[model samples]
Target chain A: MSKQSLGSLLIGMLIGVAVGVYLGWVQFPVEYTNSSMQALAPRYQDEYTVMVSEGFLVDRDINAALQRLAVLGKENTPDYVQDLTERYISQSNFPAIPSMVALSEAMGRLTPLMEVYRLPPAPTPTPFPAQ
Target chain B: MARSPRARNGIRWLALLIGLVLGIGAGLLYTWEIDPVIELNTAPWQLNPAARENYVIAIALSYARNQDLTLAFDRLRAVAPDRNVWQLVADIACERHRSIQIASNSDIIVMRALEQLYRSQGATGCADGQYPTPAPIVFMTPTPTSTPIVPVGPQATKTPTPDLPTPTVPPPVATTPPTSDRFILARVQSFCDAQLDGVIEVRVFDARGQGLRGVPVQISWGGGQREQFYTGLKPGREPGYADFLMERGRSYQVSVPGLVSEPRSIEAIPCEAQRDGQTVTVTTSYWINFQQQAN
Candidate 1:
C-alpha cells in the first residue's frame, strides 16, 4: 500500500485497540467478571456437580454412589464440596437414606486417606455395624 | 502555519473534553446502580455499624409498642437482611429489659399485664409461661392479748397460808402485737426438684390485707444473655401472676408500685416432689407495707 494509506491504517488500529481495552477493563467489567455461574470456577462447579450427583445415586444404591464419589475425590477438592455434601445429607429423607452401617463402611474406606490429607472425615450417621 | 497550530490545539482540547465526560458518567453509574446491587447481595449481619444500630433500635421500638411482630421482623430483615430473626429478637429483648423490679402489688399487676401482652404477641424469653399455680394469699394478723386480771380474793387466802410453803407465780411476759402485716407471695407444700416449666402464681395485697388487682409486676432472669421481662398480672389470676420457667441458680426480682416498701428478690430453689410432677423450684417473694408515722 502507499505510505499515506499505511499510516492512516496504523492510526485507526491503535484507536480501536485503545477503545476495546477500555470497554473490557472498565465499561462492562461486571458482565465479564461474572461469566456464567457454572464457569465462574471450574473446580468448585465440577466438585459440587459430582457430589450432588453421587448423593442422589447413593439414595438409590449405596455402592454405586460410593464409587462415583471416590472418582470425584480423586480429581480435586472444590471450595464448596463440604457444603454441598452437608446440604445433600440434610435434604435427604432420614429414613429413606442409606443405612448408617453401609454409609459408615463407605466412609471408613476414605477416612485414612482423608486423615492423611488433614481433612475431616465424612459425617457418619449413628448405628454402625460391629468392626 | 497559523491554521495548523490552531487545529492541533483544538484536537487536544477535544480529547480532554471526552475524557471528562466519560469519567463523570462512570462515577454516576457506580454510585447509583452498581454499589446498591452489590450491597443487596451482602448479608444483614455484615451491615455497617451505624446501619446495624438503627436496625436494633427498630426492633426495640417494635417490641416495646407491641406492634405486629411479623411485620417488625420483616423490617428487621430489610435492615439487616442476613441475620436469623428469632435469634436476633432473643438477643435484643434480653439486652434491653433484663432487670425488672417487683417491689409492690402494683408493680406485680403491671408486670403481669405486660407479660400477657407479650404472650398475646407470641414473644418468648426468660419470662415465658413457666410458673406453678399461685397459692392463696395468707394474711398474718397479730393475735391481741388481754390485760391480766388482778386476783384479789385468792391472793388474800394465800397470804394467810404463808406459814405453809408460798407458791411463787412468774410474771406474764410482756406481749405486743406485731405492727406490720405479712402476706404470702407463693407457697409450695412440696418443692420442685428440677427445672419447673410453667407459670408462677403471685398474689399481691395491700397492707390492709385487701387483694390488689391490676398491679404491674416485672419478672426477669438470665436468658439470651441480656433481656428484661415485664408483664402485668392477668384479671382471673389476681392479685397478679407472672409466668416464668424456674431454672436452678437463676434469681427473679419482683417490684410493685406504691406498695413496695422495699425491693424484693427471690431465688428459685428446687422443692420436694408432688403428684403429677407439680412442684415449686423457686418461691419468689416480695412485700408492701404502710409507711410508719415519724415519732
Candidate 2:
C-alpha cells in the first residue's frame, strides 16, 4: 500500500467518527421528559385522546370530557375532535366515534360530518307524583 | 528485530487513537439503538404534557367515586413517577382553572377532582374554590327521651285481711326490636341496570314497586361514619329513593329511622360485566328497599 493511500484511509476514518458522534449526540438526543400534554408527540397525543374518551364513558360528563381535552392545546378543540373523529371513521374505528361526537356536541361544535355517529339523547326524568 | 524508539512510539500512538475511535463508535451504537433507555416504565415527570393530564384526570375520577385518597395517590405517583404527586395535581388544576377556558363539565369535574385530591393531601391550589366537594354526610344517633310516671297503687292502708292483694303487673309494653319486619321490611336486590350510581341506594315503597316519599334513612359505616339522609327529596332521583356513595372494601349498615325494619349490611365490592360483547367495569352496591307494612 502507498503512504498516501494509508493517510487517506486514516483521514476518512477521522471524518466518519466526527460525523457519527455529531449526529448521534447533537442532532438527535434521547428525550426522557415531557411536562405537558401539548408537548406530547403526535402518537402519544392520540393515545391520550382515546383514554379521555374512555373516561367520559365511565363518568358520562360531556363538560369534563371537553376540559380534559383542553390539554391538547388546540385553538378550537371541537374542530380538532371532529377532524379526529373523521379520521377514526375512515380508519374503521367505530367505537371511538360516538364519544368524540358526544364531546363535540357538548362543545356546540357538532358538524354534519359527525351526524352519522351522534349519540342518542338522554332520557328525561318523569316528575314524581306530588305527595 | 530492534526498531527505532521514535518509530515504535509513533506506531503506539496511532494504535491508541484507532482504539479510541472504535471504542467510542461501538458505545454510541449500543446506547442509541440496541439498549437505548427503555421508555416503557415512564415516570410521570417523563410523560408528555397531554398524557400526564389525562392520567391525572383518571386519578381524580377514581378518587371521586371511591373517595380513597391512598389509591388515588398511588395512581398519581405512577404517572408523576414519584414526585410530590398531590402537589403536582393541585398545580395542574390551578393552572387549568386560571386559563379561563370552558371545555365542558368534564373539565370542571377534573379540576374539582384535582382540588379534592390535592386537598386530601394538604395541598392548596387555584382551583380550591372552583370545585368544592360536599362534605361526607354525618348522622347522629337520636337519643330517646321518656317522661317519668309515678306508679299508682291502692292506698297504703294496712291490709286488714290476710287475702293477698291482687297484684297488677303492667302489661308488657311491646318494645320493638332493632331488627324486625313489622313497620318496614328492607331487602337489597341488584340488577345490572340500576339506573343510578350509588353505593347504598335506599328505596321506600309499599307492596308495589312504586316509590314512597319522605322516608328517613340512616347509613352507618366503618370509622363511625354515619349519615342520615331522606328518600324522595333529591328531585331528580326516582321517587322513594335516596343514595350515598360508599368506599370499596368497607361495610355499611342501613336502616330506616323510627321503623321496625331489619338492618341490612353490605360490603362494597368491585364488579365487572359484559354488555353486547364489551366488558364494562362496575362496582357492587347495596340496594336496601323499605316496604312499609300496611297501616
| Top TM-score model | 2
For DockQ, the strongest prediction is: 2
Off by over 4 Å in 1: A1-16, A26-28, A32-111, A114-131, B1-6, B9-295
How high is the lDDT of residue B149 in model 1?
94
CA lDDT of each candidate?
0.40, 0.64
Q: Give per-residue lDDT, candidate 1, residue B250.
A: 71
Model 1 agreement with the true structure over B13-43: per-residue lDDT tens digits: 3344444455555544554455522322333
What is the lDDT, from 0 to 100, of the residue B20 in candidate 1?
Answer: 46
Query: What level of docking quality does candidate 2 show?
Result: incorrect
What DockQ does candidate 2 score? 0.08
**What does chain B score (TM) in every candidate?**
0.25, 0.40
